[model samples]
Target chain A: MTSEAPTDLAIEVRGLVKRYRGGRGQDELSAVRGIDLGVRRGEVFGFLGPNGAGKTTTVRMLCTLLPITEGHATVAGVDVGRDPAEVRRRIGVALQEVGLDARQSGRELLELQCGLYRIADPAARSAELLRLVGLEDAADRLIGTYSGGMKRRLDLATALVHEPQVLFLDEPTTGLDPASRLTVWQEVRRINALGTTVFLTTQYLEEADQLCDRLAIIDDGTIVAQGTPDELKSELGSDVLTIGLDPVEHDRARDALLTLAGLDHVTDAAEGLAVYVDDAAGAVADVVRLLGDAGIRPGAIALSRPSLDDVFLASTGRRIEGGVPEMAS
Target chain B: MNETLLLARRAVREVWRIPAATIPALFIPVFFLVVNLGQVNRIFPPSTPFLHGQHYVAFQIPVSLVFAVSSATSGLAMVTDIDVGYLDKLLAAPIRRTAIVWGRLAADLARGIAVSMLVLAVGFAFGARVKSGLVGVLLLIALSAMWGVAYAGIAIAIALKTKNVQTTNASFIIFFPLLFLTPNFVPLDLLAGPLKAIARFNPVTYVITGLRDLVLFPDIHWGSLGACALTIALTGVALTALSLRALTRFSE
Candidate 1:
């Protein structure tokens, strides 16, 4: 309920590397390749990457779920390797996998979770958390019967029961439908508002762009880019102008857009032509006039600022969803 | 120790949530006791002094207790924990990792002891009497329960390694050969050929022989009892080491 920002740092990592045995015969698979990161107290920091990009691996290391194979990290002022138990006690984790016991009701599971942490008032805390996640009505119902979103909400609730100083959410909304994802987002915001330092990893660009104070884009087991969403987008130095034209007019539109002096670059899209220009408002008129003179009128024209997806595409040469490599089965 | 005890109590509470599964787990030993007793009474000669003049039911009762105790798959419990994500949840907790294993073992041991007591009561009703009376009966129950708890280490180790129900279930194949190869079904003196030779080395053989002595014979065989105790202790140490090793690999 407090609104004050925390002054101390909650987590710090420097050139952290984690490698696993890959390709059968004891060969190494480097999941996290020397990534540096820092999470301030009371801030919502997002780690954005495709699946298998070492986001989860990094989170696991910070939470002390997995040992650090190389580099060094500290969580809540404790070395990850030297004092893992102390780190564990100070941090809460809700993994991508929903690990709820189906047989235990929401309330019962929370009570058990509270007991595990040695909380003095487990029952009262469980009740409060159930209310926090809006699961008060179904508190006594078996978790097996809950919907995907409901389960995720309860998982979040369980992570917050002990009031840990740092909370880690790894792809917290990966499988949820749009509506459920929104609900989880709202709860995440609520949690962050309460001064808990949130270390969130998500594949959804829009989620990270909207929720994170600062974001890191990881790729190939290392961080490829890091900045605030706005700051990252500002690096592009211009707005994006997209023109949806008929397939037959694609070549003509590309030529016309490229000929324009203010336009920086032009890329063909399935929908139409995406043109990057220093000033979208100034360039749109010239682009439309040139298309009109060339007798190649576009079906639709839209201008927007660069988004996280564009930032990812610029840095990685492929979209986040497209470039991720599949892990071995 | 407090953390272990607390976790053990939680494990016991978790078992009650699955009534359907618990019902069959509790029923199998009782069913085997009843069905086997009826069949053995009809076939085996009456008042036979196979070993110290023990009746068929009395001699078979301890074997039933051993089977009941050993039959529980801590592996199944481990699989359940792995599936529900509770294993990682426990590992992430601030408590000692050993508490997770110890807690489940303690719960299984309690369940094994309770089941053993129930089987003993059923045996007593069906004309199985302990020559050493109440004290002897208590000792037999304690020893048999200890054996059950000790054997669960194997199940837990297998569970941690495989992390699958089918794999853990298949690990029980070792139990069948173990139970049958020993002097479990017949007297050690009566067992012939390779089985008789192997029974000499089977640890369960000593436990069965020890329990029979404590329950059916007027005099306790301290040597066999000591051997059974040593086997239980060594098995516990070995299985505990295996389970912990598997657990370390699990988090990796």
Candidate 2:
């Protein structure tokens, strides 16, 4: 169904495609095959995908770092292909690969970046950015000495220097620890709060579920599902009740759970049998009682609302974290 | 213009930040000039009318400067850019693509000029004279720096395409032939056999001949100077284009 045209739509893509010639005796592979999306301004839009799922490719195209092989895309009202330079002007990007000049101190590098963006009062801006990233204390230190998290923060700061309309972050927290990941999340929220549209790509489902207003789940170079976290979860019907039984009785447990009236889907996770049904509260008690009657003693049991993982499993019949072959035909 | 200047300034500032590396980059050519002159001058014939009766040290000073300039590769900087992802960042920026290429080229040219002038000053300490005077001195510096910048464009193109520092380093094989095939040591007229024929066609031979004419000869050789300038300008344009093409491919 079509929604109202967003007045603040900062990015729009219609059937965008990207293809790459595989190296060393391999055939050509299409990384992104006809993906359409729209990201509203001042909202954190996440593109969630596993590694090599064309997340970076899509972000690159939107940021004007890459050319579209086919189809059309626009960033902040500028066509990515026809006017990439202008798109670049209105957008800031922190790519998956951190791009800090090692020889330059944090202050010097930021100053140079400000100059490149033709920012007025570069020194003040650089100082402010350094402070924003919590690098003011070490601003004079060379970037080579900064830790990975520090580098990432500096990169984020660099992207914000130009006050861009759209900010694209490609898997920004891939290598960060939990605390640093949270810090990046906070900065991302802060950036969005400043009236900038944030387009982020991430592998962490929880991160997207927590931070993104809406997200597109991409797999094998295509958008398989798109909606808010709650909307996608709602599509899976109701809650999920996972019952873990002892002594490896998964087959019997699966068979027994599938016969329940309210249950819609039954699948096996490593730890237990996952039962999806219309009402978790109704189904969970029945599931345990049935398992007990069948002489199946559950060691541990959990009942909760359907998560993004369940939504992914419902659509693709595979765990979101499971390895899928790169560039699905 | 502001973007170009900013980029060029960053390149310069980066080089300055690492004194250990920058010092060696400047020192090697000056050291070679001192050590080679003492040993090579004994074999050279007496100075001719074209050489303006200058001593062997005076004659070789300009050649050494040219040699020094030509040897400064921009590949290391390109490799650094690749490692830090700055190259990709620049590609994604709104700045003119040509400005990125030209800015790097300009930085290389400026560095080469600075080093060559430093070597020339050292040579002057040893009694070398510029026969065409300050104007000739300026031309010599410009030509040496241009050659360096042109060759740097080639280096940058190779670095971008290969994306491997070792491979780019090994590609200096091309420069070996360019250096020795030219009349780097002796006058072009004094060369012999296939070497003389090759020197006639070598672009660097024209460059060195032009520098030698300005530094050692009494009169200006405008034709050689013009040819050298044109070759460097054209080569810079071609290699810069190739580098930019590689950058586009890389981003894709």
Interface RMSD of each: 2.2, 1.6
Two-chain DockQ for each candidate model: 0.59, 0.67
In candidate 1, clashing pairs total 0
Q: Which portions of model 2 miss their true places by more than 4 Å?
A: A1-8, A23-25, A322-329, B20-39, B45-52, B121-134, B248-252
Predicted candidate 2 versus true structure: per-residue lDDT over B49-133, tens digit per residue? 4446776667777667766765435676787788777887888777877677777777777778887888789989877788888
Instruction: Look at candidate 1 and tell me the lDDT of residue A299.
Output: 74
Candidate lDDT scores, in order, read 0.81, 0.80
Candidate 2 lDDT by residue in tens digits, A73-176: 87887777777778878899899999888888999889988888889889999999998989999999989999889999999998989999999998899889
Model 1, position A60: C-alpha lDDT score: 84
List the candidate 1 regions with Cα displacement exceeding 4 Å: A1-8, A247-252, A292-295, A322-329, B22-40, B51-54
Give me the displacement of residue B104 in model 2, in angstroms.
Answer: 1.1
Residue A220, candidate 2: alpha-carbon lDDT:
87
lDDT of 2 at B78: 82
Can you write out model 1's per-residue Cα lDDT over A148-254, one digit (the tens) per residue? Answer: 99999999988887899899999999889999999998988999998998999999999998899998999889788898999999997778888898978877777
